[model samples]
Target: MYCEIEENWRDLDIRYLSFSNICKLNLLILDGERFPILLYDIPCALKVLHWTDCPMETLPFTDHQRYELVEIDLSHSKIVQLWDGKKVLKKLVHLNLSYCKELKEMPDLSGAPNLKTLDLDGCEELNYFHPSLAHHKSLVELNLSGCESLETLGDKLEMSSLERLDLKCCSSLRRLPEFGKCMKQLSILILKRTGIEELPTTLENLAGMSELDLTGLSWT
Candidate 1:
């Protein structure tokens, strides 16, 4: 089953719904000004959760309940964090949190082993990344463009399958993590308008690199 609440509905309360009858629901798309305080009643079989402009700070589901989810897009929301601690999302593949200006924390991706795309563009408040991100081998595209508060990306990245990495406009970031030797499939790397002064020698490992944007970068 699929349900989509129109974006014009500014004051719809999810608490009044009968969740018991919607146990088999698979897709839910909500665009509203404010969301319910808790989302624990959402169906366990849900696969797609696209809630743009949501006002919630955190998601209220356990690891077991979110296991079936395949894609999640909470762009333009006010979420500071997704949930507490690490949650296993084995079936999750795509996650988009773009333009979530208040976002500061990221859950561990060690549990989401098959995750392919992660979009965090315009997340201005995010400064630190979860350690698990450095070793996520299944990620194909990772975008951190416009993350003005970001300073570093740990010491090294080991995502062998990553194809594109966008770090444009990260004004506070001065350095990049060393790319792993297995990252031969990386094709695009955007580093426009960042604080980085030098490139790591490991960059030579990306044999498939087709685009490397260095516009607005100042060399030391």
Candidate 2:
């Protein structure tokens, strides 16, 4: 039987019996269940998973292996971390962890080669990003808006396929990493409401950039 969550499964011990046939799952707004849904029976073929307003401190991964997940959204959760270690998910394209207030770190994303969009907006406690993100050659859009604690980008950003980067409202950010020559595909760069006082002259090298937002900044 397909267990679509219409009501909360209170104190459920879901540690066995794999739902091997289910491909997609969405937990809309089920409440009244205890925090940390002991998930273990999840199928390997699951492609898309969206669990909003989760109270779990961390995800329950059955094992350390690359998943077939293409999209995963854990918005408004208390999760502090996504996974335990590095993983390989070639088809994983999008990952949204917006509004995860307790989230402090990101995992190694070097294996998700085709990842296109990563949304980390409203992650107030996230102070550091995994360095592997700078080397993602197929990333298209990165939304780090409202990351109040983020202080800086990595030492280098070499995303050749990136098109848009949103860093608005990152009040703690003071400096940006040097952009590589591969930033030729960048078209939109948002830097509104940040602590960045000055930008590197290397920014002028983005010949294809059509939109650059520098609002709420005073010339120094």
Candidate 3:
């Protein structure tokens, strides 16, 4: 059974909910709203937040709050830009900001040491993945597919744990990190439907690489 809060809500002014009851938020619906107001008044308890059609230009959150947040799914939101300098998400491990097409530039990721997987797929307007992302020394998987405006990767992409890289459909991507010399831990290199015509002669750089997936290439 499904319930809708906007249509059947008993109280219109409820502000806080316990972490276990987050599923109740799916029932609430607002028209063209700026993120759900479910827990706007509460602080540091909710860990996972998923917004459907929320038009948040900036996640106004800062470094002051000690949060237990882990997985954040903001896919297909109306966000335009954001860069958290303080890196408030100490527990954040997997972040999915896919298809938030308006975001222009990502912040210098010098503080997010625990982040492991970052999915920025279909974010076409996102041009630069800050080289400082290399600062996330623990990052293992990064997906930049459909980021048509992207042109480069970090100068150094060889983290000891870094493994999978998906750059499919990034049509405008021209420059790549020096693969044979810089990326030693990368294994699965996905370059589907991209503008790449050839793998760098130095493709041997990924010493442990197992599968090189170039699924769709106009030139290869």
Candidate 4:
């Protein structure tokens, strides 16, 4: 089952409605100026949640509740943080938070082991990544383009299944992280307009890399 609110609506707060009885409701798409506080009221079987431009700074999911969400897209939302702590999200695969300019923190993703795609492009205030991202084994695509305040991508990246990484326009990042030897599947890497002056030696380990973009980089 799917539920979508009209995009033209304004100030619609559906938090008072209970969705726990809708056991099969799997998709929810909401758009508005005001954010809905329905995380606890929504059923656990929900698989897709798309709530662009929501004004909430945080997702209020209690620590004891577990949801079987597969995809969550809150791009351009006002969220500064996703949640306070890690929740078991074994079924989650895709997450998008692009253009959330006020976003300052990334939640620990150790519980979402199967996550494949993470999009954080244009999040200008985000300066750091959660440490758990360094060891993600199932992630395939990661987009960090336009994160101007980002300086480093942790100490190392060991995502063996990652195939694409986009770091374009990260003007504050001066160095590349050490890539794991097992990252042979990475095929596309974009580092355009970054502050990096030199490439890491581990770039030779990507046996499947077909595209490497280093345009606008200064080799100082």
Candidate 5:
């Protein structure tokens, strides 16, 4: 059951529940709200959540029950962080925080081992990524295109199973991290329109790479 109401929830003396519970919710799509929509233990069994342009500063839960979630799309929201710290979300596969300009940092990714796709495109305020994310053995596709403030990928970062990495249009990025020994499966590396001066010597280590894009670099 879904309803669209224009009333401001903050002005009402609402009871404990204004919406019914769906025990096995798999998909949810919330329209953009002028005011922030506060949620409690709703969508308990949710597998997918799409709340673009939501004004919430943080997500509610911070425990193991968050593991039931598989995918989340909060693009263009005012969220400053994902969670306090990384809790186990083993089933989570896709996370799209694209265009969330207010986001400053992401939680440690040690717990979300099975995450496959992470889209942080257009997150201008995100300056750094946690080192633990490089150890993600299941991540396949990572899109950091248009991240204007991202400066580096940490010195000791490593991504063992990542196949596609898009860094197009990151004008501030000047270097890549020292690739660890396990990045053998990485196949596509896109660095179009970045500020990198020269390819790192570690390029020799990516033997399995099938495509490398360096379209906007100066030859001199």
Candidate 6:
């Protein structure tokens, strides 16, 4: 069949995709229903993969696996666990899992050294953040807006590369991180409509920040 290479994924509606066939495509988006297929042979050229509204309870990705995937968006899905601290996705830069209500904990991300941004908006069931995220020497942006169930940020979260952080609607968060020294790289920090009563006096240490959003945080 002389099908155009550009049209390869145009008609993959909702069926079990044989790894060998779809593994070479640069982009893959799965919707409709979640199919059971393990051993994802991510294409060497794949740059983005989105699993919208799929009902996957567990992901079987391992840390030893190697690939060139960069963006992963699992918004509006049912992924429950990434189990244990293993991040084989070395090249991933952006990760979005907004509105995943069944998601519970943040995956241990010490292995994804190059990861720069993560978006976990609206994960109502989420309760904690990964402790190793601070170790991500390249992490720059993080969006935790609408993670209403999250209670605390784990210890050791001092990322020199962190620039922008958004925590809007984190209703249960009572305290913010304490960064006392000059943060020349820190820029934007958002905390609107949350229950937070105060900001760390370390606010003065934010040397390079251009905008700080603390619109609705009042103990009164």
TM-score of 6: 0.83
lDDT of 6 by residue, 12-111 (tens): 6434544435545667665544564434544555667676775666665544667667988888888787555675778889888888888998888877
- Candidate number of the best TM-score: 1
lDDT tens readout by residue for model 2, 117-198: 9999999999878988988999999999999999988888999999999999999999888889889999999999999888
Best prediction by lDDT: 4
Candidate 5 wrongly placed segments (more than 4 Å): 1-22, 64-66
Query: Model 4: what TM-score?
Result: 0.91
lDDT of 4 by residue, 37-60 (tens): 565555789999888897888876
- Deviation in angstroms for 103 in model 5? 1.3
Which digits, one per residue and each the tens of the lDDT, describe model 5 over residues 32-53? Answer: 7635554655356677778888
Of 1 and 3, the candidate ahead on TM-score is 1
TM-scores vs. true structure, each candidate: 0.92, 0.86, 0.78, 0.91, 0.86, 0.83
Q: What's the C-alpha lDDT at position 67 in model 6?
A: 61
Minimum summed lDDT over a 10-residue window in model 2 is located at 25-34
lDDT (Cα, 0-100) at 118 in candidate 6: 87
Tell me the spans in candidate 3 whose CA falls farther than 4 Å from its real position: 1-42, 180-182
Winner on TM-score between 1 and 4 is 1
- Model 5 earns a TM-score of 0.86
Indicate the worst ten consecutive residues by lDDT in candidate 1.
Answer: 33-42
Q: Report each candidate's C-alpha RMSD, comma-separated, in the order given.
A: 2.1, 3.3, 4.9, 2.2, 3.4, 3.8
Tell me the spans in candidate 4 whose CA falls farther than 4 Å from its real position. Answer: 7-15, 39-42
Checking candidate 5 for backbone clashes, the offending pairs are none
| C-alpha local distance difference test of each model | 0.86, 0.79, 0.68, 0.88, 0.79, 0.73
The order by descending TM-score is 1, 4, 2, 5, 6, 3
**Ranking of all candidate structures by their lDDT, best first:** 4, 1, 5, 2, 6, 3
lDDT of 1: 0.86
How far residue 40's Cα lies from its native spot in candidate 6, in Å, is 6.8
How do the residues 143-177 of candidate 1 rate in per-residue lDDT, one tens digit apiece? 99999999999999888899999999999999999
* lDDT tens digits by residue: candidate 3, 118-194: 99998999987787675456789988989998877766565656788899998887656665355677888888888
